[model samples]
Target: MVDPRRFKSRSAVNAYGGLGIGQSVTNWHVVGRSRASRRGQRAVKRVLFLAGRAAIRGDNALARRYANRLKSGWEDRKAIRDVARRILFVACAMWIRKEVYRDELVSVPSPTR
Candidate 1:
């Protein structure tokens, strides 16, 4: 599986380095907040959707569980938020560990399950 970190461009990596909210670069406040514009929200949604889709093929147990819920009639947008939440949760965990986001078996069952 492709490492999602590789998708981060050089600039993003630099941005991550300068990130003050936490250690993970992807943990930007705009991601979880209502501060972004409509277009920005759409973009973030796309990213979250793509990440959730990819997670189905990955070791991210949370993502897989979310995908399953999606298949069971949950709205795609809600499922995407679940993915975003998982992403943020992992990001926070990474921040606490002083490490970058790592692909792991996210042992917890998904909330939507």
Candidate 2:
């Protein structure tokens, strides 16, 4: 039995699809098309890698904020993952809100060390 009402964040859904969560979606076709275009695939991979690196640094506020959350449990790996998850959530929410990623709102971080 599957819960159709279940809500998953955009990235989570994408990841699930990428991981073969349930039935196959047309995502593979999309990915194949993306990869077929060598330039597009390279650009995408570069962007993803850059974003990942930025998250590890102090420049990305979203990552910093999520790091604070993980501080409660003192698990760096889990914290970084949570931050990545939130980043995807924010991207999805922004798309739904028909707006761009506002650095001002998401940039502010806690005054903790």
Candidate 3:
């Protein structure tokens, strides 16, 4: 596992340019229908995206988040990107605390929509 501290900031983990988490809402653009951008770490982004998909296929907080996003009318890629971003944050937190991931740490309520 990669050391979270090495990232220094959440933006580093997300790697969508030097933009912070708030800026990510506008700055982060996943290149799905075009050539890949040379900005962020493509390999890391790919891994996170895949992890999000795997999480959605299982019973976990990430899956719940994915479901909620979908229920809220988010597009598939958008919801998956949201999950990937969340997974990055959670992974960083766990790595920094030197603790294993516990689904209980995240409380995703059942989707009402």
Local distance difference test, each candidate: 0.51, 0.48, 0.72
Best by TM-score: 3
Q: Write one digit per residue (lDDT tens) for candidate 1, span 5-112.
A: 542453343233221122223655433443222332345446555766677666566666676767667877666556654664565456556787555546544444
Clashes of each: 0, 0, 0
On the 0 to 100 scale, the lDDT of residue 109 in model 1 is 48
Q: Candidate 3 has what TM-score?
A: 0.71
Q: In candidate 3, what are the lDDT values of residues 1-113, reduced to their tens digit?
A: 34567766786667652112332233577433442234676677778888889999998888988899888887898788778888888877887898998998876756666
Model 3: lowest-lDDT 10 consecutive positions: 17-26
Candidates ranked, most accurate by TM-score first: 3, 2, 1
Better of 1 and 3 by TM-score: 3
RMSD of each: 10.4, 11.3, 6.0
User: What's the distance in Å from true for residue 93, model 1?
Assistant: 1.7
lDDT of 2 by residue, 20-107 (tens): 1233238554322221112223443344445544776766677667666655554554454445445555555676677887766665
Better of 1 and 2 by TM-score: 2
Structural similarity to truth (TM-score) of each candidate: 0.43, 0.44, 0.71
Which parts of model 2 are misplaced by more than 4 Å?
1-53, 104-113
